[model samples]
Target: MTLQYIQDKEGKTTGVIIPIKEWQSLKEKYSELQEEVEPSTELMSWQKKILDERISDYFDDPENVGDFERTLDDIEKSL
Candidate 1:
């Protein structure tokens, strides 16, 4: 993608100019650019219950829980 630069009278870059087509493509590829998105602020009851169950399970079998490296390695190997 070629970007055009806008310079001030002092020759310092003041802004950038992306082609409309490229800008539209970028907006499509990146969700944040597509709109003003709001993130979920609170967990619903079912979500909380699921997390509580997971926590209880962890406490019940602390030794069996996967560490970060092991979990990441398992994911990567699966992929």
Candidate 2:
């Protein structure tokens, strides 16, 4: 990978210049790096609470967690 640095008038490094082909290849390889739309304020708060509660429950009783293989078999049967 090659990198070109952009400098200010004072010769201080400010930005980078990437070749178009290299940039395109990087974009394809890391498509998920694209900007994401954030959830609404209310939805974000609700999701945080739900996730916190789930983590707490899991830690409170790790033994009570569902069996992975059995859960998959049950799901397949339902389908």
Candidate 3:
């Protein structure tokens, strides 16, 4: 697992950064860490179609594809 640390000027580790998937996993393991917010698990049909297309694209060229963040940024830019 890759994590980034936010450090203070004196080099003290202030906080740790993790991927969203890992955060969700942590929330599942520890009840105390969970919040009241519950995100929807269901994807709309259009969302599912887009995901399927992206999965197909990924399988076609696994090495050349952008990571989720970059892809999301590109999408947001287009929007």
Candidate 4:
């Protein structure tokens, strides 16, 4: 599975070249990765908390809450 890189004037790789057999083997191996990889639990939890707080704060304004809820409801209904 030998691979070679073509570099540019800046010495950065511009492209890669692999044998057909090696490319075929790589394709077969990659095809086995059929599942969506979930993010780490801690990261996901932190993201959820941050999003929830942002949403909560955005809706805390009386005028904005009505528009936000209406927009959210419309989006949910469309979904």
Model 4, range 1-79, lDDT digits (tens) per residue? 6899999999999999989888777667887533333344565778889999988887786455557688999999999
Give me the runs in candidate 3 sitting further than 4 Å from their true place. 35-79
| lDDT of each residue in 1-79, candidate 3, tens digit only | 7799999999999999999999889889987777555666889999999999999998998897668999899999999
In terms of lDDT, the poorest run of 10 residues in model 2 is 33-42
Ranking by lDDT: 1, 3, 2, 4
Give the CA lDDT, 0 to 100, for residue 32 in model 3.
Answer: 72
Instruction: State TM-scores per candidate.
Output: 0.45, 0.44, 0.40, 0.36
Instruction: Name the lDDT value of residue 3 in candidate 3.
Output: 98
List where candidate 2 sits over 4 angstroms from the true fold: 1-43
- TM match of model 4 to true structure: 0.36
Can you write out model 1's per-residue Cα lDDT over 22-44, one digit (the tens) per residue? 98898889988766545677899
Candidate 4 regions with alpha-carbon error over 4 angstroms: 32-79
List the lowest-lDDT window of 10 residues for candidate 1: 33-42
Candidate with maximal lDDT: 1
- Residue 71, candidate 2: Cα error in Å is 0.5
Ten-residue region with minimum lDDT total, candidate 3: 31-40
